[model samples]
Target: MFKLTTAAAEQVMRAAKEGGTEGMSLRLAATQKEDGAIDYRMGFDAATEEDIRFQSEGVDIVMSPEDVPLLDETVMDFVEIEPGKPHFIFLNPKDPTYQPPADA
Candidate 1:
């Protein structure tokens, strides 16, 4: 299963609140490119019957069945890469370009 860091969860909640999607789950999708890198997308959305639902870091999440294998063991995090600049990042072992954090 995929995991979300506390920082990521807080940011997700803030975005959901600002976007007026309080009741909707965060939909996550992944696509594998020709180069074997995984592209990730996320947004607030309603869950469909074919979607798989789960909760992480107190945030609701939904994903299609096809995304399971691609996202398995993935970790999503929000970090400040530079002063006053924060961004979301995916540490996916399945992605060819993935690199382990230096501190890890």
Candidate 2:
């Protein structure tokens, strides 16, 4: 199962509220690139009948069945990589370039 850090959940909630999608689930999708990198996309969206639904940190999330293998074991986090530049990041072990955090 995919996980969302607390910071990421908070940020997603904020974005959803600001975008007037208070009741919509956050849809997450991922595709593996030819170079063995993962491409991630996420946003507020309504869940379809075929979507898999789950809850993490009080946030609703939906994804297609096809995305499960690619996203499984992935972690999403919100971090400030530089001053005043916070963004969501995907930490996926399946990615060739992915490195485990020093603290891990």
lDDT (Cα, 0-100) at 18 in candidate 2: 91
Residue 67 in model 1: shift from native, Å? Answer: 0.7
> Which parts of model 1 are misplaced by more than 4 Å?
none
Candidate 2 error regions (>4 Å): none
Report the CA-based lDDT of candidate 1 relative to the real structure: 0.96
State the weakest 10-residue window (summed lDDT) of model 2: 95-104
- Cα displacement (Å) at residue 56, model 1: 0.1
User: What is the lDDT of every predicted structure here?
Assistant: 0.96, 0.94
For model 2, how does the per-residue alpha-carbon lDDT over 1-104 read when each residue is reduced to its tens digit?
99999999999999988989999999999998999898999988999999999998999999999999999999999999899999999899998979888884
Candidate 2 local distance difference test against the native: 0.94
TM-score of each: 0.96, 0.97
